[model samples]
Target: MKKYFNRFPHAVRGITYATGNDFGFRTQVYLGLVVAFIVFAIYSPLSLFEFLFILLGWFLILITELQNSALEIALDQLHPELHDSIGRSKDMAAGAVLLAGLFLTIVLIALLLSRLI
Candidate 1:
């Protein structure tokens, strides 16, 4: 158990690096944090499913951002020169992030409507 807990700092460092290096990742984190604060603090009487859904939505966004940023960084390192294929790969990764954000937004909206109803 003690050995398992030692990896947290590495994860934190990764977060720091990503936050510093990727503007889009940072923006997603900030917005996700706002929604997270609202859902966890202001929202009331969350069912298990709703809580899980919220967590999953946030996870999906973060996961995609990490993937997208990592791809861009690696690709840039591998081929610093501009190329059409590399640009297309980056664009598709970005598109994935956009789709994830839309899904998260839909989840948030559904939760809000549920609270109202």
Candidate 2:
């Protein structure tokens, strides 16, 4: 299990490939946003639960993006040519991430509103 866990760096390397090759600048921008929000949530008036939500949501986004990258790589390896099935699979993974993000947004809004009211 330790060996298996150690392999995660390689898996993350796959994600790094996407950031470095495809959208290095955009990836940096998102990273910056995540860091900024984390800092603000921790040091500002944000509740501990709010910080937890942000961190959990951030993790979900990262993992889903990594999974999508892995799927794309495996699909390319199996078939270099474009295919609808592969596209659908990737889209489905992205959709799941979007759904989670929507929930996270709602949680943040609700938590903040409850505090205010």
Candidate 3:
């Protein structure tokens, strides 16, 4: 438990570094906030839990992206060569984020349409 608590700082520092240095990460953060606000403002009255689910999905994608970025940076530092396995690993991580985003987008569109109708 103590070890895990101690490691929290490092994880937070990594997230901070990524948020500051990665343009894509920053864009996603901004977009997530916007989507979150829109969801809460428009959907909360109907279903707070559903709005929370959407926010959770957004956080999940952002977390996965940060982890992916960390892994790619570590792999690059270890060896900058065009390694096939490393590339595949990075791509798979990115694919997770893409899939999550696609699902979330569909959910948002459906929810918004339902709300309007």
- Candidate with top lDDT is 1
- Which 10 residues in a row give candidate 1 its minimum summed lDDT? 36-45
| Per-residue lDDT of model 1, residues 1-117, tens digit only | 877789888888888999987898898888888888878886776889988888888788888999999999999999999999999999999898889888878988998897889
How does candidate 2 score on lDDT? 0.69
Relative to the true structure, how large is the alpha-carbon lDDT of every model? 0.88, 0.69, 0.83
Per-residue lDDT tens digits for candidate 3, residues 9-81, read 9988888998999876888899999988877786777577677668777887788788778888898999899
- 1 against 2, candidate with superior lDDT: 1
lDDT of 1: 0.88
lDDT of 3 at 89: 86
Give lDDT tens digits, candidate 2, residues 3-114. Answer: 9999999867766676676452346338748765765865587678777886786667666666666676788899888789988887897787677667667766776677
lDDT of model 3 at position 50: 71
